[model samples]
Target chain A: MTHPAEIKALVFDVFGTIVDWRSGVARGAAAFLDRYAPALDPYAFADAWRAEYSPSMEEIRSGRRRYVRLDVLHRENLVRTLDRYGIVDVPDADIDALNLAWHRLDPWPDAVAALHRLKRRFIIAPLSNGNIRLMVDVAKRAGLPWDAILGAEVVRAYKPSPQVYSDTVEILSVAPAELCLVAAHNGDLAAARRLGLSTAFVLRPTEHGPGQTTDLQADDAWDFDVKDLNELADRLGCPD
Target chain B: MTHPAEIKALVFDVFGTIVDWRSGVARGAAAFLDRYAPALDPYAFADAWRAEYSPSMEEIRSGRRRYVRLDVLHRENLVRTLDRYGIVDVPDADIDALNLAWHRLDPWPDAVAALHRLKRRFIIAPLSNGNIRLMVDVAKRAGLPWDAILGAEVVRAYKPSPQVYSDTVEILSVAPAELCLVAAHNGDLAAARRLGLSTAFVLRPTEHGPGQTTDLQADDAWDFDVKDLNELADRLGCPD
Candidate 1:
């Protein structure tokens, strides 16, 4: 079958696709600011934190620093971002609590329902740059029912690398063609396709919130594309 | 509290505790012999195959060879054992099929029911020497309802290693004391307890069938000792 009849597993990109991480962080920070840091601009703070994501990963990739998890990376970025905004005097405990904002990121409205549908047909897991500890914590805190949590920590390599995709297939013991990578980002699907994985694009136009300029729609002729995860599950014939 | 409080996760040792491998292999071999080679002593064949288990693990542990997964080791052992018994007429495909006996292991009668009970209260996973692919396949084939499968493949290290215990605890993001290792063998419990993990022993005295010489009963005081997994769950207040 030219359609790759053996695709038995689906690995998801968590931040934008499965969960509305940007908006979730904005909301979480808004709540935190309302409760404690009343003077902080929660939305601006959320954007600043999201913008630091890549630079922090680059620091690790470039050997400017050793490996650190998203939780630790978020804390470091949070402290620096707060300092940049002239908000010193944040308590260490509060900073620690704020770092967990990522853990509490809310799934998109259709995420849980869609995953529930997909779980009936395939092994679904998070294939992300998040560390295992971070992802597992997020799963527990957010009620994401992943069959397994596959992450950078498992292979100690970041995404867009062929090793990451190959390592996932090796660890899962499934052939490259027997798994599909589902993400909102074209770059992730491009990388996975290079390593022989099938691809599905689920649009998350507001991943960066209003005026999000990238990944607003499918950028390539991916194996499958849908408006959201629920639609993607349906397109794949995952029974409800 | 002397009794463990608020156990949030339960990690299991797979081999003898969950599945009756010895009896399954013996029965399969007896049936295979009855169908193909009436002259063979099927019980002796089963014991010979089982004898390879410890030496295979020892070989890898003592650095006589690289880390070969139990699946590969079983296949190699089966080839040698079948040769010794002069059962060479079996096709290579059949030999490959027979090597998968590990995957076809039958669960102990109480395993599913007790794990179902425990799952209602705790996140359940298998902390096994088996590789991730092996464990996942076994869980699927044997109808094991593990919330996740954590194996040596995750850390590339075998159990009783502090790395394995710490990797699991770190991934689950729980304190060592909040996680308990439940196993049929005493040594497994001793390792967990030494690493500050709560330990529960489920006696599987017949794991090796008649000639079972070790772990016949709880050899040391642990956090909990019960007759079987069901009893252990009851002791832990896992509701029916």
Candidate 2:
């Protein structure tokens, strides 16, 4: 797979690719569980917490409920995760603070360097499920030098939705061909590729924590595939 | 005036404030008119073209017409300006290309450095009447570093509508106090202040060209009244 010559902007999928959410959440949850409740299975709890992401968003998407930011959604889902495991000792303030752990999620080592390099040539932004405020908070915390932040909050539609990707490109006034979607998830890239967007796959082998299996390899013919964002930047000509 | 600690972000009024639109349009129009018809008074034509902005937008606001982007509004206004000036020699393509002069407007000298310095400490975006694509283009052309671009296109409500400014703060998830309205126009800043946003008045004495009369001096006790954006940054603790 080759880079499209016309590609001028690169939009990233943040969660698994740019930030190691699984391990970050796991570490944060493990630390909390260790101090608060040693009896809980931290790994299962981490998986369960992430498991709620889809259905929680679905509740809003299907119009079953009004729009809720990821922070609120995360708290709602956290209570359920705790209830299922019979662990209710955590206080509300602690839970509220912990929910913001999403903001402090650590990026992949290669993430910052790659983005910094890529920013030199392309208009770089994160087209993510996170809300604008959440993304901005994360960027400031992680020092991710994003040129702009474009998120589901702007369009009120989550990724894999053609509207989200198309609206993003339209907002930038760049042809779909000039924008590339870089992600660790195949489904995200596949959706973007279908909409005439170029695609790049950056492998995040440990994104799902210790037993993670999927997305460890680029299973599709994306425009570019690299070990990390720094390599992608090198390939894109971001100077050292 | 003391800096409002509550204001964490600053949104700008672009047209006459950050960019010298009158001169830009006049210069571009003169070149365009010269190429099309040698006889038209480019200065009067520029004023005539600009004179259509408010009424055209008002038509959309009153539901007398559909929501038309500033680009389309400029084109419509340009045609009428050409007709009034008896300029019959211009082709449609040239007119269409020249109507994009708004996109090519030059930034005021203080605009870039002030925005750049302020961006180091806070999130900076344009809360302008320009459509999304137009603002994005202007930022790229003028090298204005914005964390995100917010405009009337997002809310479909023009400035001073409260909905426009409030929707911007809501979308960015910043409280009204956490956002400052920085503009050369009192009407715009007044509306923002009414909505509980902090106000910063930067004087653009020549915004209306040499015939400018109003907004030559800051009238009210704005939170910060500075000569330029750099001065604003210096007051705000941007590094020297």
Highest lDDT model number? 2
In order, candidate lDDTs are 0.80, 0.82
lDDT (Cα, tens digit) per residue for candidate 2, span A52-88: 9989888877768877667778889888987887777
- Predicted candidate 2 versus true structure: per-residue lDDT over B36-126, tens digit per residue: 6677777667788999999888887777877666887888888887787777777889988888888888899878887878877898888
Q: Candidate 1's residue-wise lDDT over A1-240, tens digit each?
A: 116346788999998988778777777788667765688778888999888888888887776787766677788888888778777787898888878778778888898888878876787889888877667666766677777778687777778767889999888767888889999999999999999899998888888878889988878888988888888787778776
Model 1 chain A poorest ten-residue lDDT run: A1-10
Colliding residue pairs in candidate 1: none
Off by over 4 Å in 2: A1-3, A26-35, A38-45, A87-92, A234-240, B1-3, B41-43, B64-68, B88-93
Whole-model lDDT, model 2: 0.82
What is candidate 1's CAPRI-style docking category based on DockQ?
A: medium
TM-score of chain B of each: 0.90, 0.94
